[model samples]
Target: MTTLKSGDKAPDFEGVNQDGKKVGLQDFSGKKLILYFYPKDNTPGCTAESCNLNDNYNAWLEKGYEVLGVSPDSVESHRKFKEKFNLEFDLLADTEKEILQAYGAWGEKNMYGKKYMGVLRTTFVIDENGVIEDVFKKVKTKDHTNQILKSLNI
Candidate 1:
């Protein structure tokens, strides 16, 4: 769905987080960023992916990486989801799908033989300079942290 490739410059984005704080690309200028776009909040797959990241949050931090989740859900929804799951990362509220579109994570999808436009689960590993280091289109929700670590050869 996304035209963004491994070496492309990650598109600049700004959105409100669960705490209603404005967050943007510039906020993480000198750190490796794990930007994951999921279809919705609290869904089974989404939860698994997020929880795995939360469980390994310190590992990521120790490896110099920061994680951020994005979805078209509202801030209130994000807040509830984060609290329920005890998520340790910021979940961006992209209600308008602006950031999703910029990253090419919003696109048509098929399920149960029905086609509709929705968010494509994707993860972009961005370097300190904001250049994409790797793209994970086939994300393994249950083992996402290990997947990322393997990608980074950590």
Candidate 2:
């Protein structure tokens, strides 16, 4: 439930990636960034979404975009997830949920009639200048690359 929309300045964020490397919005300066937030590491929806993106990573690069996945999972968890999926993009370990909260990606979620706080799956398409170009709140997990490409009309 992010309030940020297309044309807004993307929130500044710094996170540790799967390789224990610091990654931030500034690192993507002069490049379009696909910043995605998900709930967990090995879940079905997350896997589908991530795999779809990974499967088409080359196309995204050819079109001038870098992808970054973020989750509340630990660095170790992210590492395993990436390795298992052969993901080419970096996955950020937001254990503290700091970046998630900053982007409004962490909030109340209801499941099975119970409410709990969790990651709100969302993606922000940021431009080279750090401005958000698009926001996907209802991502079609199994075909995310096409979903994003279609929305951006690329």
Who wins the lDDT comparison?
Answer: 1
lDDT (Cα, tens digit) per residue for candidate 2, span 1-154:
5588899999999999999999999999999999999999999999999999999999999999999999999999999999999999999999899999989899999999999999999999999999999999898999999989999999
| Candidate 1 per-residue lDDT over residues 1-43, each given as its tens digit | 4599988999999999999999999999999999999999989
Global fold similarity of model 1 (TM-score): 0.98
Q: Could you tell me how far off, in angstroms, the CA of residue 143 lies in candidate 2 after the best superposition?
A: 0.7
How far out, in Å, is residue 145 in model 1?
0.5
Native-to-model Cα distance after best TM-score fit, residue 118 in candidate 1, in Å: 0.2
Regions of candidate 1 where Cα sits further than 4 Å from its true position: none
Predictions in order: lDDT: 0.95, 0.95
Clashes within 3 Å, all models in order: 0, 0
TM-score of 2: 0.98
